[model samples]
Target: MRFGGFKRLRRFSTSRRLWVALVLLALLAAVLLLQQRSEPPDEDSGNGYAGLGEDAMEYAQAEPSHSLQFPGDHGPHPDYRIEWWYLTANLEDENGEPLGIQWTLFRQALASPDDEDDDSDSPWSTDQLWMAHAALSTPQDHWFDERFARGRPGPDQQGQAGVTTEPFSAWLDDWQLMSRDRDSGDLDSLSVTARGIDDDNTFGYRLDLTAEGPLVLHGVDGFSQKTADGQGSFYYSQPFYRVEGQVEIDGEMRNVSGRAWLDREWSSQIMGPAQQGWDWFSLHLADGYKLMAFRLRGGGEDGGDYLSGSWISPDGNVTNLDDDAIELIPTEHSEIEDREIPTQWRLRLPGQDLDVTVKARHPDRWLDTVFPYWEGDVTVEGSHSGIGFLEMTGY
Candidate 1:
């Protein structure tokens, strides 16, 4: 969607453009923070939030060396520059109508761990920025919204946005995803709530998710690789969730139930200089297996793509997948929000005896947020039948 006709729209303020950038690259918002530390107030650096130049040594980076710990790792890792708690549900309404929902909270540190103790007289000073995004898609229509906030990092959590490991809560304003059991680790049982407003009306959801299987870590025990040179993030997922909740849209509330996938990852930098974007997939097969795969465009082995994933058995055994084990190819395209997007894809895992074609229920599932992208529930056909979510970025 393009803004036109209004002269004021032609000269969107710097803050407005920043908000657009914040939504488009929410996970990489720390780049803006780093620039703020180096630039003057009146001057604007259009470099945006990405790329690690001189600051490479100033912050932490993901490696095959660091091991991920639960509960603590599930919370915030402020030492790293970027992290996000992402959730996507493949659900159905009481009438058996298909519905896809999403709720996410992103945290990007303005300062490295060493800068956390910087002298500041004001109690409201903060070194952390928070952002949230939520969306809902039915068979015929899609609704989405974005939010932003500022707060102090750890040891100071009395702000508008923060996460706690004890009760395990990640939130911004009234929107949050919290643990139902304080004593439970790995966030076994949890509740999620997020609300957003668009032109159509208000749409949001409150859902309960219970894990039926153990967590599946990506790459080498949660140390996911993004490029051949070893730049990546710590990635893992609770893909065996049995979700039951209520969805409220257009002032009407209805019950919903289905499967949900929870992703927790953090990194100083997930993209290299030549990388454009990525295509991520999370599918639940009919035979009780789960598949998580992604292709990092332009930032892979020998400047191609860093393709990798994880194959999770029904009993929770994980088989780490690299470029050799899987194949991801764009099969079809659709023009949405002025960009040609691959709404249909073909994925294969020869060892698992799985060869499937994934298709979006509708092409209109384009999320016209700060940076528009395609994220919607997908149906699998070919060797097996099931439902899942497909995310394609960098159009």
Candidate 2:
């Protein structure tokens, strides 16, 4: 992700006020988990595309998805309301000291707020936008970055977001995840480069990643339902990356090598109005299995949040997790950026008879950038002693 500074004026204008109003409205709309509240008289309440009424009629009303094709699957699904390519890594330098890294690109379709049919201009005119965040952390310090862009659909103009297979490149300008060969679509030899400049500092990185394991998909046939009513998304991951790269802190280059995980998911409507944020984890277990889990936390007790995960066996078999199957409880909270974040967690998997305690490798891994959050390297003990990445967003 890239971070840039725009020139600022001392005065406010009518247009600025309107922009502020739009942002507030969007935030309010997100907080209204539609599941628990009664729909308006004119609204459609079914789980199918028909329930979305004429607004989103173009989307197919098919049953939960099952088949997923690769190469093509790595690209965008514009019809979806949201999509992202998230990567995290747990690594150690030559000294064996631990370090962690994260890079993610998020796409949010602004036009389909409630799946209502609202005809605007060109499909490119649709209000879709993109945002990205990247971070790096060591026991002694933490570094973070954030970037935002507008989305376009066609090739003449670089869509603010895209993923290509021919040369195996995926990126959104200066900030990108691309193949080094520029000819081979092999991801094992690809390079991930991202740069960001902020008032406090300027940071960037370019890393070479080689896959150590196979790619894993979550849920049944690629459709991962996140809510009780079957609201869900398509999700998959590549979690066995052996990375050797360099990160530029301020103006110095530091060589680093580590393990990395990449996650990609897309959905037309994933979260209900009540859902506010999420706590996500990607652990690289010492026992050979990798664990990926997330909890969608809705507001208050009246509405229920959702949880799902994948348990990757050493040999690369992926087991999908149901809502009732996984649990992550906050054992302690630390104040960062004037916000309380759970720094320690108790993770439980009932069916596998697994229970583990995870603690931050250090508490200061919090990224204090736009869309600030705590996403850093962590260590898991109890049932298994291993290293992993923890990501807590929206809170």
Candidate 3:
């Protein structure tokens, strides 16, 4: 009789596992179907909102002067329209060859948490959407891929793609970035891993990042103003990570060590109606200084360009920069896929007496994702010499 009871228990466990697997498969299919029905904004239309500027009166707005708390704010803000965990690295292989990497996880709310009905308890019900992007760039080759998933609400049901704050983990499928010390919840030290295939070329990385400096807040107390009308985001960064790891490209692996920057921002309206897109830069100067700057195509005073940045000293002190304090100019352009992209730029910050040319290492670093853009490693020259990353959108 005891043997029979054990056999019954074993069968029950197997059946439960099978049922859970089937449920997950169904959830994934539903997410993909819904994602396909949704359309991205037309890039050529000069859409200022990136399809995110729509009225979100029901969702939470990123108000100024609200304090940002750690470990808690590190996780998802489902009440907002959009949020992202963005990380970029500039590394050199064992042979001293340069490589670039970008990993991002973005979360968008399908509906307000308050709108969740009785079906919210169902395993298939989800009001959150998660998307992730992974890319690896070589001197001549760039590989990129993206993934999407649905997020389950509640602490016990994390679904396929979600972020947890207690131990600091953010994942989609197998790609993950989490705290190195599972017992700690801080973002100072992390381990990241991701792999993807593009056009017969396989690429990925497994890196360990250790923060060397304190976190830096941008704009006014971590409230970054995006437009002249007080619209913006809660932005901050850990710009002093020392990274060492292995990166694989085209099935070839190499050991690498370098610097990385991680950015955290969330907002309901990151751009105004007239603002098209932006050109953003994160530079690591050779002299132990760092600069974060951006130029918005429109929505400034009198519908002009809006500019903002933060000049960081080696110790992580931040000096917020205004539009008049910095200058950004496109010096050269590259015609890629029939689009004229500014592959080279001249950046000037008068307050720090810094004048530098920031140019993309290679122009083919375009990410042809659902919302295509150019993002890759850049070399800084002129007054300051160093390496960093640049992201340009809206052509």
Q: Cα RMSD (Å) between model 2 and the true structure?
A: 6.5
Model 2 has how many clashing residue pairs?
6
Q: After superposition, how far is residue 168 of candidate 1 from its true place, in Å?
A: 1.0
Across residues 62-167, which tens digit of lDDT does each residue of candidate 3 receive? 8786999988989988888789999999999989999999999988766654553526668766666677889998898898876767677564427678899989
The digit string of per-residue lDDT tens for model 1 on 1-395 reads 01011111223347646644543353345446566675442332111123321234467878888888877898887778778889999999999999999988887677787765554666545567777879999998888876777766347665678888887888888898889997765578999998877774789999999999988888888999877887778998999899999999898998999999999988777666566667889999999988999887766666587898988899989888888888989899998867889989889999888899999999888666544567899999989788999887666
Cα error, candidate 2, residue 45 (Å):
13
Each candidate: what lDDT?
0.78, 0.68, 0.82
Let me know the TM-score candidate 3 reaches against the reference structure. Answer: 0.87
Residue 261 Cα positional deviation in candidate 3, in Å, after optimal superposition = 0.2
Lowest summed lDDT over 10 consecutive residues: which window, candidate 2? Answer: 46-55
Give the winner by lDDT: 1 or 3: 3
Candidate order (lDDT) = 3, 1, 2
Candidate 3 regions with alpha-carbon error over 4 angstroms = 1-49, 116-118, 155-157
- Top-lDDT candidate index: 3
